[model samples]
Target: MPHAYQPPQRRSRLTRRGRLLLLFTALLGLGLGATVLLPLLSPGEAPEKPRQLLIPEGWRAAQVYAAIDKE
Candidate 1:
């Protein structure tokens, strides 16, 4: 009987742990991307402009505090 020549079989590079790690990394990336993009994509209220206070010159500190409190 003559022996037959057979080619060696190749194995996968990623093991079970590697596959799980890759999946976890992909999921984490997707979660981070969604977190960053969701606020930008959704329709939301525009930010209100800051209110400016016009204080006359020579106003006392107490007057300024009272005006701020009133507003």
Candidate 2:
């Protein structure tokens, strides 16, 4: 008698635990890449200082125009 042939069982889809583990691994990889790679890629220029402007609180449009005209 010939032995009966049987098909292999299909693999199951990822479970909740497997999905969470994949997500954690992806985030850890991205974090490591940023920490190790960013400084090496950045140029050595000193960071530009931001310009400061002082606008008085509650100043109306007319007041701003008058101030500009006085200059």
Most accurate candidate by lDDT: 1
lDDT of candidate 2? 0.88
Q: 1-71, model 1: which lDDT tens digit per residue? A: 59888788897699899999999999999999999999999999989999989889999999999999988
Q: Write the per-residue lDDT of candidate 2 for residues 1-71, one digit (tens) a residue.
A: 59888899898899999999999999999999999899989887898898655669999989988877775
The local distance difference test score of each candidate is 0.95, 0.88
Candidate 1 Cα deviation (angstroms), residue 30? 0.4
Which regions of candidate 2 are displaced past 4 Å? Answer: 1-3, 45-71
Q: Tell me the spans in candidate 1 whose CA falls farther than 4 Å from its real position.
A: 1-11
Kindly provide the TM-score of model 1 when superposed on the true structure, using C-alpha atoms: 0.78
What TM-score would each prediction reach against the true structure? 0.78, 0.49
Of the candidates shown, which would achieve the greatest TM-score relative to the real structure? 1
